[model samples]
Target chain A: MIEEVAVALDVGGTGMKCALVGADGVVRHAERHPTDAGRGPAAVVETILSVAEGLAGKAYADGLTPTALGIVVPGVVDEARGVAVWSANVGFRDVPLRDLAAARLGLPTALGHDVRAGGLAEARLGAGRDTGHVLFVAIGTGIAAAHVVAGRAVTGAHGAAGELGHILVRPDGPVCGCGRPGCLEAVASASAVARRYAELTGTDTGTATTRRTGSASDDGSAAGPGRGRTMVTAAEVAARADAGEEVAAQVWRETVEALADGLATAQALFDVATIVLGGGLAQAGAGLFDPLRAALRDRLTFHREPRLVPAVLGDEAGCLGAALLALDQMETP
Target chain B: MIEEVAVALDVGGTGMKCALVGADGVVRHAERHPTDAGRGPAAVVETILSVAEGLAGKAYADGLTPTALGIVVPGVVDEARGVAVWSANVGFRDVPLRDLAAARLGLPTALGHDVRAGGLAEARLGAGRDTGHVLFVAIGTGIAAAHVVAGRAVTGAHGAAGELGHILVRPDGPVCGCGRPGCLEAVASASAVARRYAELTGTDTGTATTRRTGSASDDGSAAGPGRGRTMVTAAEVAARADAGEEVAAQVWRETVEALADGLATAQALFDVATIVLGGGLAQAGAGLFDPLRAALRDRLTFHREPRLVPAVLGDEAGCLGAALLALDQMETP
Candidate 1:
């Protein structure tokens, strides 16, 4: 008798990552590939199949046959139907990715939402490893979260659970992509922070990056104002604040304030034991954690102050989560 | 070898109801008495004790000595502490209802929020029976709800999980008792409906008890200013709609619209299998159900249409739910 491995694939907006995981949750082999999603769903599916096959080859070389496969993607996924009902980034609609993968790989397959899968990874093995109730929030391009209760991620009745981003904050602030106004996403998302800073400084800054402010200079400090106008992103704002930039300091304060407000509302509702912060903005480290914690403490009165910690497993979380789903499917059936 | 009965009491703003529930979930005896809450927490506690004794005495005469007691009251409660933290109606603040009852009745005791208890009863033996995820909403003089997941009510980390009424619906509409503007309670509650209609008509018709339309003589049908001015409570409003009152028809339409908006928000966030309607306003029967369904259908596009049903066990639900909590306490210790 031979023990078989499970292949986990995570497809994001930019790239695809795959890993071969054993029954004991060890990643025996891992690989990454560019998604090039602008070529559409067909190309993306092809890339997924190729990457999965590549991972399977590696596992076979290691003298193992993959028993099952798990794939996680962004957007509205109909997990029961094994279809990605709609996806904005990958240009997919009603694509039966599960059936395609199962047939191509000759293994049982499962599909899920990327953020939810990542949250599942965190709940099972990351920052919220021992927590019974956990909420994993990804604060990158836009804010989104997934709720994991008692080791199970609630997919919701209509498959739209843990959409903390759309929870309205100001009720009359900026309009959101979902056509809602003043959503938490509109205020606290990393993209929102960058947009707000760019709007304030009136500069078309390149990709936002962090830099130390160095001293308490009013106009500019270590990172001099390029073209008499210092343009900065969320990361830069946080870095400069740590280094003592007055303008960056103010922007950082506002960003933390908005983030706290949104997190407080989430606290009042879910009362999750731990809130694992992930995605781009969280990379700011204590620059993000410190003020965010202070803001939450200031806003919360009677609600539980959840332990806010950075997510473990990073970009590979979604892939691991998807693998877990596939493993569970094989065992249950 | 005989099972002992327990005294279950539901303390509302206006009255207190008692029932002797056997271990098998049967109500062996039932009684009601005025709460007279204005007399303060001391008086209310005394009333609850006296009523429990009466119910216990009846159970004893029937060869079943009560072994435990359960009491449910309105407002914020610290169940772990066995204290009624705050209840404006009963004027109780940090009052140890469970300890008081246990000492008085010489039995194990349980105390809980009134609406949450009702929700538990619904989940176990009423409309939400067999449903793992249920949201029990009580739209009465004030509005509140309880989320029942896996047949257990979620008390939240701060004991304020089911405060659905406090969710802001309108950003600048009417003011709510919680000092917020345009809360779900202020917009969709039964009291809000009557108050709104009264404000428009400026007639304190003293609890609109009947629904009436204009004479049917005009153009072979009821058509006039009074056709839409149904002089009735929500119950009478339903009756008038049944009897073809044009005025009551308008009022009923507004009620459904408001409720549907609120419920739609709940549906999007909770994604529960069923939403059980309870409390005083729920007495409208089909008046509430028919229009609410239509309104929900119109508003929802990607959400599950929750199965809406009337809460069974009526007012006794709270007591039974409290008993369930008591049973949990007994089993755990």
Candidate 2:
């Protein structure tokens, strides 16, 4: 018997990545394109449909038919209603992506938040596999998370269940994009780390600096987009620290402390078995993982200590997660 | 057809309550006794077994042999392991309550945390009826909560999922009984409310105040024994406040604010449809509910507001919930 196939797509603020994933979880064909999200939802939808169509054509040529299509996007999404209630990145309000994609591709389709899709992937086959309760936290351009309980992602009543970034860590610490003061995202996000570094040292090293007297400039050129003026990006800071930069080390220490603070709060609230860290910051490996683990341990006294690990599926996690949802729908239907 | 009856017992820090509950959701016979928990786990277990035996004997004499037994207690209870991992009030440490109850009663048994059991009752037939996700927060001698998803209470991997009272609200706040600073419980529990009132005022209510300030007496002498000179019972504070005492009013305001803060955080994290407040302090009716509602409303900015209501089943909820779990076990087996 031939296995089924689904075309999965993850639409982000910067770009969209699509994959023709088989029942065996292998991506047979893949492609990517800039979202140009500011172009409005319709144009973005067109791009999504065109790329999905291309992937479907490729699958057909490979002697496989796409049984369903799964697409994941950012912002507050109503999975049950198949409506995108709001999307800060894509200028979407109440866009029924599921029905639109189904109409466009003539197949069963599902819509989900990008973070939840990643959580589903981790819950089913990655770090959180088989865990009764798992939290998948993604930190990159911004911080967000998704929860899986009993092997299913919790979409909450309003489709805004996993807004970990908005969780108030500091009631009046820093201003966040959500117009909130002292949110976890405002302090612990990758962008926030870099921004803090720049604010501290009065140098724009693709980052922000804090109120610390230190400098870790491995290379002479600290002047770059978000870097070189003593304020280096979290990446630049990490690199400079790796190359024995003093200022970079200070910034790195603060970043880990902030991440641990946010994560400790998450652990206490959910008390889950595993926490899967994904997105760009996680790519730093030990630079991000080691200090974070130490900080979390120091903070937790009564709550169960959640095992922290990097997300396994890389960039394909969201797409594959969506595919898994579609697969469940197909099998049950 | 004759309805099956189950023997249910609720063990509290001060006393034990037992009932013979019918499958039709009605109590046929009820009784109570002092828990004497400080004597140790063995004595507590004996009291529990004797209570169950008495209830079962009454049911049998009434021409209905109890089908199962349900036991609900406090502290960190591991339901899957059938053990009461630890309970400061019960003097228990890893006591196999389920197995012991089953062995003593000669029937199948189920054990669970008292608050979670009450939450199960509320979710199934009370305030949260028909709600998909419900968080039942009980403010009493100690603070705790239970989450019900799809009419089933979620027991996390370590049975520590709903320790809401321990969530650190202030990093530099008051020291809690759990040895943590600024824990929700340390400031919100019935005892905490009274303790705070005492700390603020120089009068002592003659009772170890529980969270519910509504039951306190006007004069400290009438409250109870074993209370400190500067400590008024939470009940006494509520009583004075009811009579328009300014000091009592201030304490009440702060208590409600802290409860609202904790609830708002829980609302943001869990997004449950309803929150059922139970236990001792919940007995305040409008006094507690009205203020908490207003406070929660003031804090909520971006989350779906869950309906707040007093638990309908009152003290019998835990017994009924335990019965339901036992029945579930029987049916599944």
- Tens digits of lDDT, candidate 1, B54-160: 88788888888778888888777767678887776678878988898899888898888888888998988899999778888887656678878887787654455
**Which candidate gets the maximum DockQ versus the true structure?**
2
DockQ of each: 0.18, 0.33
Write candidate 2's Cα lDDT for B89-145 as tens digits: 667778998998889889999888777888888898788899888988877756788
Alpha-carbon error at A44 in model 1, in Å? 4.1
Return the top candidate by TM-score: 2
Error of 2 at A37 (Å): 1.3
TM-score of chain A of each: 0.88, 0.89
- The true-structure Cα RMSD of candidate 2 reads 5.5
Per-residue CA lDDT of candidate 2, range A163-224, in tens? 77766666557766655566666676766767766667675443332211000111112222
